[model samples]
Target: MHSLINRIMPSASGAHLFAVVALAGLFIWFGLMNLAGLTEATVERWLQPHPLAYLVTPYKTWLPYALGAIQLFAGVMIAIYAVPQRWKRVSYGLIGAISIASLSLMFTNPVWIESLGGFPAIGSGQGLIKYVAILGVALWFLGTKGANEIMLIGLILVLGWIGAMKFTGPEAEGVWPLLTGSPVFNWWLTDFGKQMASNIIGVVELITVILLTGHWWNRKAYEVGLLISAATFVVTLSFLLTFPQSWSGGFPNLSGTGHFLLKDAVLLAATFILYRD
Candidate 1:
């Protein structure tokens, strides 16, 4: 099995090394930031519009610290080439767990959906559909190489749901006009652009999810999947920066865009380590 893996696993390139190191550094930073309680200040500022702000507020207290620690651990393990070898199943299992929690939060939290709103009323339905979809996706990750597949399926579902909601829902309708009509040229339309960009990203995410999930059976495909995942992280960072309002907070506290972008940057860096030998 060791010989088979060596023959199958491609040699690590400069790009792979850079990505792995970056991932480790980011996760280490993330974990440290959480331990320092920086996440609380960040989350408190960004969640102004959330209905269950009070209910989820506890996250500010511990989640950042916890996830940051996880990031650091995952990063170190991957950087050392220990995860996909000695801890492959455990590593994937953790990914699956995180994905499930993320999906659950999406359904339960209006703020999350609101962050990605395309039109105005598209964010309706009281968050039930999102929960069901997230749960379904998370369930797909229980088997071997299931995390990638579940992610891909979730992205497809998110795209479809958002697209359909934008067309038929009221909130989405409000946001869509800014994208299509005359006001699109205005600076204020930046919010609309951000949401649209997120939707477009959803398309790419769907593709990546499918490619990564299915790549286990084909080594070449697996390599491509890693590249796609890295690219998605870059795209998300660009998208968030481009639309300041999408972040929804003041400066210094690292609310709104600051918080999210930082988190994602960290996530990207950590995940990239998985590609290295």
Candidate 2:
């Protein structure tokens, strides 16, 4: 099979160019948004349910500016081949640091879906999960061979763990709101029953994991697994459009459910790289 870069990119250097442009562009977009205060409200909402609620005011006021500056510099440093090696290292380090810090927020933030009795219901914490993939993006840009695997691991863990959770009651109920919002998925609830429908999805996800794992023996299996994984993200992202309740304060302001779906974008990117590589 032809390497995707060969078919789509002009040359081997195109791979590096792709990473630099995509990753740096994402950071640059985020930096500009944060700097413009467009994300301030969203940031404030995320902090509200945290134990450090007292820090919300101070944090919201300054975090956007600080993160914006860091992101802008990091984006520039990574994108410019002529940038000093020292600055590139600093940019990579900053990306790693911020990614780790954001991932840590999952533990500290309120994650419970109160109506479903919390624990496995996963709320605001879902928003932070993509930092894992972002960290992988950083590693890739920094020339790590394991970067692709890092992202694959992210997809596997998300599917494997959440797939397991689908067997439980709270999880089934927790996803009910999202499932009902979609005309395509709603039939599953009515026809198969809630738990059964969730179980079906869980089975598919687990099978995809199995396929990804078994790829060592059958390249075809690996290839299929990546496609399935990519499809999974595409479906979830569709929820952002199908589910009206996805938004807390309209378009740009996302609710917990919105965050959950949006994070799948990064997971989708994970599958894309795995397939490309």
Cα-based lDDT for every prediction = 0.47, 0.72
TM-score of each: 0.44, 0.72
Among all windows of 10 consecutive residues in model 2, the one with the lowest summed lDDT is: 1-10
Across 154-222, the per-residue lDDT of candidate 1 in tens digits comes to: 333443454444333343444443334323233454454645643553455566556555445766565
lDDT agreement of model 2 with the native = 0.72
lDDT of 2 by residue, 194-233 (tens): 8888888889999999888754677767767877887787
Native-referenced Cα lDDT, model 1: 0.47
What ranges in model 1 sit over 4 Å off? 1-29, 41-64, 82-84, 87-89, 111-148, 163-235, 240-255, 258-277
